[model samples]
Target: MDFRWWRRSFFGAFLSWVFFFLRFSCSDKACAAPEYTFVKEATSAPPVIFYDYIIIGGGTAGCPLAATLSHGGATVLVLERGGSPYTNPNITNIGNFASVLLDRSPTSPAQPFTSEDGVYNARARILGGGSAVNAGFYTRASTHYIKKVGWNQKMVKQAYEWVEQVVAFQPPLMEWESAFRDGLLEVGVLPNNGFTYDHLYGTKIGGTIFDKEGHRHTAADLLQYANPRKITVYLHAIVHKILFRHIPGTARPQAYGVIYKDAYGVRHLAYLKRNSKNEIILTAGAIGSPQLLMLSGIGPGYHLRTHGIQVVVNQPLVGQGMADNPMNVLLIPSPLPVEVSLVQVVGITKFNTFIEGASGLSFVYPLARRLAKRFRLFLNQSDYEPFKVPPEDMARAVDTVNAVVNRTLRAGIILEKITGPASTGHLELRNLNPDDTPFVTFNYFKEPEDLRKCIEGMRTVISVVNSKAFSKFRYKNMPIEALINLMLTLPINNRPRHATAAISLEQFCIDTVMSIWHYHGGCQVGRVVDKEYRVLGVDSLRVVDGSTFYRTPGTNPQATVMMLGRYVGKRILQERYLSRRSKHKN
Candidate 1:
């Protein structure tokens, strides 16, 4: 075999596998059937001519809202900007979550935006939206996040109960649990606090996990279960604008209907019939929800003018206070030669099966509870108060982190900087194109404190690696500098070498770092929507999902997002129905 032929064949095979993975594995699971035929059906139909409550964007927030609102006995129409993940091959495989970053997969429609910043990473162009392509790790909103939005503990606690009732929370079976446990115990980084699969929030460990059936207990699952007989879920439908009316005497504006486009590219507007009272809910998520509002003239007047969009309401809070989890995976080598396990692989299969049949372990709840009990070691227990400790304690913690980063140089642990100061980014409109990717400018680590946090995170990981238990495993930290050097040496796809040289403690806070693709916070509380998630100046519109969060929780957002969906859904239903009877005389 000549070198040329070998190289050509190897690269060809590699690319083939990449394309295959992108096609069949999207939903953090595997699939047995195509996930696009339904999208075809949705697109072929003419625009919806009638609906009492039209929920746009069947993503995280939209899914639950659609399902819950339909439970109100109202005629509901769910308009998804993308195709159904159930039918899209790109959404079943878990591994495709990483690969979809480079190319436009089946779910990611042509985005109308791009960014010099690396903040808002990728947008899913399918039915389940980001839920179909996310890491599947589940944690609810941090207390800081809830309070930041002016939601009291009682409200968030209630939201958690509502969310947990719908989502199956657990890890995989015994083997996966053992692996997670052994991995943590082996490193001796066992958390000192109690874990939570409960009502409380913060850095408490145990999070909601996917069961063997692949049902993630996400907004998608809840929506399906909570869906009402009157609600119609239409995949591949994108809402274009919200139809509004200026009340003749009142100071507030009223929403009457919505304009949306089906998969066939045909546009249609469903308006409120004369003398008919109707409410249009915009659960389109952080980006889509706000974008739709802006398109309908509901954002900052200046910003709207720049995009040639006429102003509906001069709500300046639109598109501000975006936050995301600064993530970086700390890679640890196996003590023994690595063995490929189908545990994660099984999750792939289960997710796909659910998309096709909506049954099996995917529909069970006990499976999640069992799984959560197994991976309790790596859980962190903290109140996650922003200023819990004194300033001196924080300063000392910063010093401790610096010391660990320095000491790791002597030990063999190669600290891979994943979520560092340089990972800070933001979400913005790339241009006037709504379908375009947003301008994601992550000026990561432009601030010094952020750099200290990354260094502290590195130190924390090292503390786990240096423990007595981990030493027994003899985990040799590979020479990470070598890996960094290799990446720098690469001709193409070479990233900026942010950690090229070690810095002194005096300069630690000033250093830069990279991102981990954990994008968050474009429509946070106290800004985008009020505590109840109602759009500030608009009636019957709300913002939910990751974007609505004030900040990314210490862990992943899937579980938290599910909670938001459920909480917001219940609140909307209550305010719309329960509060109404008291006001009526009939």
Candidate 2:
């Protein structure tokens, strides 16, 4: 076998993936979107200003909340610590789904962080938040889930419809996605609910943010509903602390304002307009919300004192009960080439397991390098870098080029994450710098129940892999099958995954655990925030994102998160209206 021919094959397949995507795939319409006049750079913000509501983190929930509040004639200022997602090709193009996650640049939309559990995960660092960086699977929270959270079912339905109109669509199934759907049913996951957003127990097709053309619609698009004149959005505005003041008669620390730094390190202050109803909202995500709370002197008294932060509220549970859905995946290499697709088909099981799958996702370099190493390609470490040895069909600049240029795999993954992970962890401030990630340890599978649930989920996945509907895609006798089976048992970073046999499923669950990015809690519902999501011991401040979630909603949390923004925004407006009417009567 000629080694040069094998290397050429690598360049040929990889370059073809980039050339067509950048050249033909990203047309002008998809490449650029009209700039929103209301969306401004953080540097341009006034040194001190006031608004009816100050929203921190212009993410999935923040965007919709801002729009809802502004539409109701209240002035809203949304401070986002990340860049706009509109023009980012890695984000806008659904086909390049993995590119953003793989790009480890400082300014990448996905902020990559490794957990203490040694699992690789990323948090959203873009205007649209996780919706801009996620797999785009959109499914609503279960009816039982909504009721448990104490949200009005009718209002939840209306809010979901509002979000669906903007970002949700029934994605057309590709060859691989269709096969995944059939396999789920073949394995008796349940009745085929077929292309619906209802969170039923069955093999069903959920909505996606990706359209038929493979262009993604993010939470930023929902900003179109915002009243431009009333809502002001500032990108790269990092809120370091929530400002609190002592009201004359109130014992609680009143959140009156926030102190933030712009991208260029200029300090800016935004305050509430001094109305009793005016509030400061933290829509910053799970990790961000809790970290910010600690930095703002709102966490445990001892923890804040250790960091030299003056404790405003001694809330011990601010960062406690943090949970991430532990996901385990089985990679199946196909004999036939598969079409690229993101999350579309799902298998919601009866036994607290939710299974989702994606196929032909060419995850930039790491996956490609792993595949190349498996195939035993005669290539040095430098050869893999486009800078040192550019692929024959592309330029040397391809190394720095923000494009998905590697397509080595033609495989599908069957992944499962348990609904309510009994095991949880806590997040603490590593430092005061808002840019730095906080110290977090989500003790995955610490609870015996969680490990047991994972074993059951993986067993269902094995059934899907062995399903007759999935048989045609793979040649069982192929050498790739044996290679993947061997790869499954190998250890990563000294953590050994047990063999994929039935008896060793427990160890496999512990070793192979990774985050599906459905991590929630930190500022939990009852402990850190009230049922209305208002921060406990702090007046005029609330957390509206996943931080307040006790359990992840639906097959994915983005849909419910986005809906929560709308749901809460409407409720706030209604509360204000009723309050005004009561004052008039008095």
* lDDT accuracy of residue 109 in candidate 1: 32
The lDDT of each candidate is 0.47, 0.78
Clashing pairs in 2: none
**TM-score of decoy 2:** 0.87
Q: Which 10 residues in a row give candidate 1 its minimum summed lDDT?
A: 350-359
Superposed Cα RMSD, model 1: 12.6
Among all candidates shown, the one with the greatest TM-score? 2
lDDT of 2 by residue, 1-586 (tens): 3454333333233222321121123323232454699999999999999999999999999999999999776899999999998778877875565467556678778887777777667789999999988777789998999888889999999999999887777766778778888998988888999989999999898877775567777889888888889999999999999999998888988999999999899999999996899999999999899999899999999999999999999999999999999887776666677776666788998888888777663544654654545433312223233222324323212221212224555666777889888889989888999878888888899899888889899888887777788887654543223323433432322245443332367766777676788999999988999899899998999999999988888879999999999999999999888888899999
Summing lDDT over every window of 10 consecutive residues in candidate 2, give the lowest-scoring window.
Answer: 15-24
| Per-residue lDDT value at 412 in model 2 | 68
Candidate 1, residue 494: lDDT: 14
User: Which lDDT tens digits does candidate 1 get at residues 1-586?
Assistant: 2343332222222222221211111243322332221223455555546767666777766676666667776677777777555543334443332334434444453222223542224465655666665545445554655675565578667766665665434443233223433433444333322345532321123433343443333356555455445766666666767888877777778777877676666787776544333566666655666667778888779888888887878977676655433332233333332222211211001011000000001101332222222212111112222213444544443343233233221111122222212344445555654565555555555666555565555444444445444443223333222222222221111123233222222232223222323456556567767777667776656666666655454344556666566567676677667556866955
For every model shown, the clashing-pair count is: 47, 0
lDDT for model 2 comes to: 0.78
